[model samples]
Target chain A: MEKGSRRSFLVFSINWATALIGGVLSLAAGIPLIGFAISPAFKKGESKWVDLGLADRLKNSRFKKVDYTFTAKDGWVKATKKRSVYVTDAGNGQWSVFSRTCSHLGCLVRWDDQKESFLCPCHGAVFDQNGIVVAGPPPRPLQKLQTKVEAGILYVKDF
Target chain B: MGFLNERLPLTEFSAHLRKPLPKHINLLFSLGSLAMFLLLLQAATGAFLALYYSPSPEHAHNAVTYISEEVPFGSFVRGLHHWGASAMVVIVFVHLLRVVIYSSYKAPRELTWIVGVLLLLVVLGFGFTGYLLPWDEKAYWATVVGVEIASTAPILGVFVAKVLRGGSEIGAVTLARFYAVHTIWLPWLAFGLVGVHLFFVRYYGSSGTPQNTPEEMKTGKPFYPDQVFEDVVGMLILFIVLAAVALFIPVPLEDVADPTNANYDPRPEWYFLFLFQLLKYFQGPLEIVGTFVIPTVGIVLLLFLPFLDKSERAVLWKRPVALTVTTVCVAGIVGLTLLGASSPKLETADATIVQEVPQPTEDIQKTATLDTETAEVEKEEEVFDFQLTEEEIEGTEEEEEVFDFQLTEEELQ
Candidate 1:
């Protein structure tokens, strides 16, 4: 081949090689970031059992407020956080723990002794003592936290 | 003469000394290259995005959220893809207008102009399809408007809408179809059209000084070194601008899909808003004429332009008719866009105001009377008499009344 053609070919080859390397590296770096951006749905699965404290502390005939902490890990990063909620007995000696997160919207629900129900401040969604939907645009019952007695201590799912 | 007569290789193409390009390549000229660069950027980022995007309606919103939040710098990548698309459309339109003003569409270059117009339509199709993939409220109804417009076409409207939507309604099928069109089909067409357009530009070469230039007037620089440098510098500046936009203001997410709600104000992206608002002005019979007929006529006119204006003159100043028409068209577009931006407050035809009618005075009086009568009846019933007969008292005193209650009742009778 002539020198000019060979030189042009070399330049084209180098340009293509650089582009290919850059593309591959970008893909390798970008996929994970894309994955991270969509991690909220996946994070749903990582929610685990959180110990809220001793079952004895729960007041009978009323909801007792408890605060607890648990660890969450996203890939290499791990975080420990505290969250509070109310715990009540469902009248059959069975404990019913509900998430403060409102079902209608995500506002925190507080126990209203006067109304004898859980009331959401953002909207007027009311839940009965057993966490059954009583009124308002809630559309569903409050989300029940998965709980168990571990050595007489109440542990509930944090998410 | 000896130096000029020296052997030149056949492989080396010689610059046409008879024609030259203008030296004053302004910012307007840079738009085409910027658009092309943006197209490439969009394609790259879009391809990356497609790898992680889930096309199911159930998962599409979640997947987009995941990509934005969980993926490292995924937000930035998606932002680049988004803003790059907007930039492409804007830059292409500006470049087309620049060509129009210079009368670059005259004679042999008409095919280039036609292809450029098609590129604009394809870019719009890209926007339409890409908007639907997120499966959010804004994406959903914007697509609904798009499908409705497509369905307005005579004879082939339903078919085209179905083909684009992938079914009777928007769902998993629609999402997949839009994803395919946005990521695969439209991009392929655009890439091919762009290649042909660029090839023609290179073959015909740049349209130099306007038609009225003196014969002795110096034309312009060659394409290789000087124009190439300008293009590179423009691309670098465009890259910096795009980078800054992507990094600082990531694309905003809207409320997630809730199909039952009808309150969403479905507007197309800002670039297409003018066309959307244009549809509004053409009402009733005129709508069909304006939306479909007029635009179709314009496109047909644009395509057959080379044959229509066969004059060899390329001078803008000499072509008063063409220049006037071009200026009028541009001014009309600018006016329509401003009107569109301002006229969003105009009520949509489908929006209805629900007014509660007050109850009549007679009905209210009748209800009050009924309540009062019911209360009086309750009060009357509360006051009951309690008296015992003599026979009942005697029966209570006798133990025999328990055993012979029938006999006692017969005696009383």
Candidate 2:
């Protein structure tokens, strides 16, 4: 037998029609499945402000580790979650708050007083006291959080 | 043999095994069979690991730790799965390189080559998904960065990341999703594609050696002892090397995942380090270029190579264009991997100058950016001077460029 044999018109049309029917049926079910799977992307993370403590007291502290819990929505589950941040007093009325999370990869950075720098054990990424990249492969400085001091209370926004 | 021949197709199989192979075929031709051997090894070990493995953010780390520390030869099996993964990637790539060098992917073997490339991708998919199963800090964070990188793709990035993550965050669902894909979906895909690949291989029959003529191949030895023996030997060597690696360098499991730990590092597995490092060169909106465009184009071009390479030339040096393309790509991947591997490992002299616990933000940048100030500061005490990146300099340098700094900073350097 030779290669590249041509098929009859009936067979050609039937094959094409069969594929069309299959595609239509598959798409009819596949679209909804895809939509259901991707539904989470459409939903935004719930954000709220978790109060830390008094703003004045938080100011001028070398590096105060502040852990706080807040009610938040994670996927379909809504519950209370605990989070932490480093609060350092920026000379003046300004209080600088930095999220201990490394900006590169989400690794918790520990404040090493011996090194006097925020050290990321995961990648050896060093962040200076002010949350600036002193060394290693952090793409950006330690993530600085949005801070608001109301009256005598200190608060950092958490998601 | 006589008893089995009566009950099974043993005689026919033995007859099939005696198929003729080109005499010119050598060790390089055995890489395909070696790759398949590694796949089988992976499948067997992965099944065993899955029996004890738990896929959840809460228990996955514990499960892996238990397997590594408690179970007899568990660490060995886990290590095989881990190192075997990298070995598989390496062997598969080398096999492809061999195919390219010889014109084996040409003509009737085009479908086989295409399917082979797809199989390589499935292997890579396994690597990506498997990295998340341990659910340790490293696994969790690396997957976070990986998913984030996925989210950087244009149009469908969000959907892609969410689907990969199985939800809004990399938590229990993400682990389960990765586990299912790694243990189930990928194996099925690999097995199916491998079947197609093997079928095509048999259908096309060896493209024969690039140097030999079909007439010469007619006078070659049968596949029974010559080729199969070589294939088995290659596999034996691979297994020995793999065992040595697993015994000496067991895979590490870092601290358990903590959602609230802001200081967690998100370094991707080594196989993905090249892509992770590639993203460093791209910033902001340009991330899509590195994340999606380049990879998509690379895959498409790789898929179409057999069609494009009309040069039926088989010898490595005969095709100048193919040689150059392969050289550049191999160099790029190697260079990028080296760069990615070395990322986040930089250590410098400690600043014993007063505890900068609350160091002035400018002081940190000034010491790193200014050579003169660093010299002056070093006069008093040892201080680590860090060169600022262009992005960092732009953010803080304009106010301090009076130090007469170069526009270029050691970003990657």
Candidate 3:
């Protein structure tokens, strides 16, 4: 009985070894095929919500201009930067955050109170209160940042 | 001896099938097979993409960027998949033309031809769904056109649009619905239909010339060693070409999507550019007819082509009428695409132009600087006086007042 058990163990070991080797080889061969299949799912860079600043500075008006700085780490390198924005209300206490990034062609936008809009000085692209293109060569309205208020501090996610 | 040889065993059968196939299977014959190969490649790459892609608008674009930049070999894989899809569309159309020119849709192969037509529609459907997955402006507006097209479908237009969008407009539901159709539903249908079509082709064995002429007819070699070898070589060549394109010229990404922006010149993907341009020439009733009616009619005509052209001859040169029709169609598509690419720019209204505010003269700037310093000193004094008191932050009221001013008139001029 002991001799029989030893033989069975040897057979099992050989089978297991063969299966393991086969599985590894199959995976190696299949990698390219699998990569071809799933390549469409891969995306290069993602837009992340970069924090802008505190909410206390943005109260009591339909629009508020606030500037804030944050550090971004790509791989091992870290850099600090500041961005300014105009946050307006879409009614009901909710805010629509506009990137001063001009819709005309990436120029900085300034608030022209007389025009009641964000004015792109570069090509004269004008956006109304809702950020619709009111005038100029700008193909689109201003980019809006996703925002949230935390503990009286305004935080915006910049793309 | 002849009967004994004909009733050969498995080994003999294998040996008999190992002969060289015909050499005359032209470049046109290759498009369908190439399309099929690319479809498989798309499915594989798309699956990998789906693993990491988030359908939610909040994360969709970011996820795409992440896969491109962060994932291992992600960019190459995504690029291959994207370019592969575009290539498949081109090849499928070419394949259809090849069939038409050769009059391969006659009697015995009618069903095969019909299946091929459906496959073309599936390819377009794939292009449409895949275009919107990136959630870019181009994708968004192209989808707007798609939704608009669906809404023009008479009694069921509204229902179709709602079902496709998952709601009234493009949103999370629309994204999810598109994702499902793109990655799941359409793929299964395409695979099954393609499989049946291919199986029938093999069974019928190349429907060669039904009306064989002694001079025009050529006996083909077997399909194994000859045709299979050529197919393998073709696949390798296609791979090399695709790799070169993907590496040398990466797909372009448009600016992020913002629905509030109306000035964006939203164009569909290049594959649909012809259709997009077609809509421009159409006005009111003509728009509906050109955009929806004409395309539908074309598709139906293609489906019933076998009956329309009941020629027995399979030699492409013998089918002059069909060949001419196919050539015209190809030329028309190519011309329309070129026109679409060079579409005339839409005129912008003058009222929307924002005027820049001129800076005051240097002397005025110095005066404003003095005024700002005085105001700062006064503000400091007020803060010092109110330090012990629980008075709210000063100037908040003034800031509120300034914000209330409508800056429209000054901006417009």
Candidate 4:
């Protein structure tokens, strides 16, 4: 078998063919699997410009707590979620909305009027009016939500 | 020419590279090399991932998201890394099994066997630590359970758990520590052990097979072309399979680590499911038996196997006791892992943990005090429910509705 030309050729083809087939088949199954796996990573945390009522009601340079409900599309099912934000008038018709959820551990944060800071009771994390961490173990400032105003109506994104 | 030749052993090295092995070498023999290839693949893909991965809790999940979504071929590389690690685990186990069945860990190869065991432990450590780097709910909770299990070790339980976690809880410190161990520590350990294992293999040469007689071993074929060709073919097949798996069944990255989400069920990676299953049988004080004693005994037995099986005959039939014991252990692992995988998670006694805090609710009211500079705070204690019911825990209904098997909701979004 070693000396025979046709036999050696057959052996060579078989060996290489096995490898080629394996490579081809793996790709056939793998490409779609990989595509399916990575699809979620590409999904941007989408939010809609949900109306938060009259923009005129929000006082200039003052923070107001706003609560709004929107249907959140979570994968296949959509659920009506009640979300809150702190909307502060930016002096010139613009409003900065901050998510009420604390940046530290997802616990809800409350504006402590006496303390003059947003306080998280879970770990005593404190944030200033601008949403920056004032004290404690909160890594960063509270997440600010995208806000928009149109025709005196205030709106905030669910992102 | 003489000086150059003397400085480098190129001629001798070339001669050594082409050294022959017994012609009886088969595809099964190539499993170890295939495992080696997968390890290299993991290292390469891991390096690519590390370029974007941030170990801190704040950016770890975001970094992973960026890698998979933003960087070109980042998802592809990540998919390869995820699936490749799983494949490596399987191949490493199979390779170990093959070594056992072949009785190749006998006599002069005792050191090789011991080193191989250490390598397996390192591979397992890599899986455990890497599992946490994703910083997802599953990763977070699973590490919590894993660390808790470690803390159950008799005298050194708390110490070991503290060392593994870097603190009392799974947080930023834990994530950074795990990242360091997985990327820097385990790879170095594997490389060092692999170098020594290869040295032993070369120094002793191929053990060939028990089937091959002394005379047959003398007339073996060269390692470079014949055996190397078989290895190449095997690796190609493995690559194709790995690629298909990566492409078709990419691993899911669940929601970022949220300790508050009680709905999430914590399960270990598939390899540890057997031991995870074992823990179910012995609860409370006897938990140590499951976590420490049984596993310790099993590993001790495996380490001392070469000495225990004193028979010179390497044939499977000749070693009845060894064969039965190995078969039983393998069967136990498979059975337990499958059982654990299929079993619905048992309910914990306290699913809901409530924390009281003053929070802004559906309504807010502000009052002016005497000073008026700082508004009078309304202290309202609200109960934040973190408990999940059995109904919520069984979330498979919605996940099944989206895609049968192609992608889970978590993977989809």
- Evaluated on CA atoms against the true complex, candidate 3 attains a DockQ of 0.02
lDDT of each: 0.65, 0.75, 0.66, 0.71
Highest TM-score against the true fold, candidate:
2
List each candidate's DockQ score. Answer: 0.01, 0.12, 0.02, 0.02
In DockQ, how does model 2 score against the reference complex? 0.12
Q: Give a tens-digit lDDT track for model 3, residues B152-227.
A: 7778776667667654546666777789889999999999999999887775556443344443234566666766
Choose 2 or 3, whichever is better by lDDT.
Answer: 2
Per-residue lDDT over B1-413 for candidate 2, one digit per residue giving the tens place of the 0 to 100 score: 67877899987778877888776877788888988999999999999999899986657889999999999999999999999999999999999999988878888788999999999999999988988898877777777777766776778877888788876667666777789889888999999999999999877777667888878765577887988888898888889999999999979998887665544446677777778777666543454677778999999999988899988757778888888999999898989888888776424222222111121244543443346533343232223222343455676767676775565666536
Which 10 successive residues of model 3 chain A have the least lDDT summed?
A73-82
Question: Which residue runs does candidate 1 get wrong by more than 4 Å?
Answer: A1-159, B1-27, B211-219, B310-318, B344-413
- Model 2 has an lDDT value of 0.75
Model 3 chain B: weakest 10-residue lDDT segment is: B382-391
Worst 10 residues of 4 chain B by lDDT: B374-383
lDDT of 3 at A96: 77
Docking quality category of candidate 1 according to DockQ thresholds? incorrect
TM-score of chain B of each: 0.75, 0.81, 0.78, 0.84
DockQ ranking from best candidate downward: 2, 3, 4, 1
The global Cα lDDT (0 to 1) of model 3 is: 0.66
Off by over 4 Å in 3: A1-159, B1-24, B208-218, B314-320, B347-413
